[model samples]
Target: MSSPQSPQSPQPSQQPKQGIACLGVLGVVALVVILLVVINRGGGGSSDDADASPSPYVPSSAPYTPPGDPYTPTTDPYASGDPYSSPSPEPSPYTSGTCLNGTLPDSTTAQSVSGVEEVSCSASDAHYKVIETVPLSTDLSRCNGNPRTQYAFSYRYTLNGATINSYVYCLVGLGSYAR
Candidate 1:
């Protein structure tokens, strides 16, 4: 009888295993190439065909106006026929008058009082003759440290031989302060 073969010897079946692995690798590569070709083919569109199509119709009623074009001078309907006509001058400031016995001439005019030593005036308040007229001095320190640009008339009268000082607290923007 022949001697028993050794178990560590090389086997012939390993050659077929290597061939199977190579075939699998080649198949994957071919599939990837086919996918790439299909994708690239769909993206290629003819530019000539796009230009041959009919363009969209636009109405001629609205002509294209370039911004660089010179602007035409417009005639104002309220303007006088004369181009050189001067604008009307503004009305003069408040008119000064004398007060009789602490009584004011018209309730609309401002007047000074000696009792409280305070100046007060209002259209709704009783008309009183103004003793003296003085411009209001505004303080902007309370306006968030910002300068006060505008002010409305608060008091029409001032103390006799005494000066009155006015102050503005809050500012008005967008109906109130920005913050």
Candidate 2:
């Protein structure tokens, strides 16, 4: 009788299993490649048919005007370069109507006020222009700051021993708290 065989390691059977596993991985890789190719080619509208230069689509009724921005207030108006380099774009904060007091004093006309204290008009707290004339009733409204003073024109001199155009007073600064 043949001698009883000794228990053996599983190496012989493992070889076939490893071969099958490698084949299975290769099969999956090939399947994925095939699927990707099919999807890329199968889209109903191919990119080849697209226009070379796509234009912005606009409605037919009217000529397209790029939308104007709804007004938004900034913390500082003179935030840009030299203040005198370009004219400031005067801002309108009030939406409902013009403020009381009345519109900006006629730039063409010279006006004056008396017993008024002088202000820097360029100070931190006084950084705005007359966008609207505050109504007298609304002059002290939340939007108004401490009624800053500015000299539209101030001169003290005598021509023929008389003072002319000696002084003019105007309020400056945007008092729009609602903004």
Candidate 3:
């Protein structure tokens, strides 16, 4: 019969290989632990780090100013000292007794005219005198066919569907002029 086989021992080279593989695993775990410690050390907002410098990300207390002139509100025309102030009535430049110079375009018949200049009644060049001033209306009956009424003129300015200014002049011939 063959001699009884002795218990086999692991090869020396295989033993060293197992040892190196275990050392590589340990090295990886140690490297991970060191990285975690480094990250936590620099992290912000820990109360325990009382003397730590302020973070660069914090905003300053001063207000940020723009490059150009600062914003300013425009003047309000409606505003007065009184909070309940109402709009004052506009005074009409052509009143009932005002005289005007410059010849009429249609001197023979009563008609609407323009380019008339205001003058004193005593002025030598005065050609027409305003007998009555009134608000303009669609009907001409107010200034039409009257014996003394020589001409009628309406002036007005409108902006954005609203009348900004308006006037109607009912005039009579002055001097030797006839209607």
Indicate the worst ten consecutive residues by lDDT in candidate 2.
91-100
Per-residue lDDT tens digits for candidate 1, residues 39-119, read 678655567755786879989799878676456545674577666775433222232332112221222223333322112
Tens-digit per-residue lDDT, 36-109, candidate 2: 88877765446775646678998879876655653655445667757678643332222222222323332434
Per lDDT, the best of the predicted structures is 3
Return the TM-score for each candidate structure: 0.21, 0.21, 0.42
Model 2 residue 97 lDDT? 21
Global local distance difference test of model 1: 0.41
- Those runs of model 2 whose alpha carbons end farther than 4 Å from true positions after fitting are 1-9, 43-179
lDDT of 3 at 37: 87
Quickly count the clashes in candidate 1.
Answer: 5
Model 2, C-alpha of 142: deviation from truth (Å): 99
Off-target runs (Cα >4 Å) in candidate 1 are 1-8, 43-179
lDDT of 2: 0.44
Residues 1-179 of candidate 3: C-alpha lDDT, one tens digit per residue: 89999999877898889999999999999999988888688754368677777767766687799776656546554465664775454545688889988766653334655677888899998888888776754234567655578776665656667777766667888877646
TM-score of candidate 3 to 2 decimals: 0.42
- Cα error, residue 140 of model 1, in Å, equals 99
Local lDDT at 13 for model 2: 83
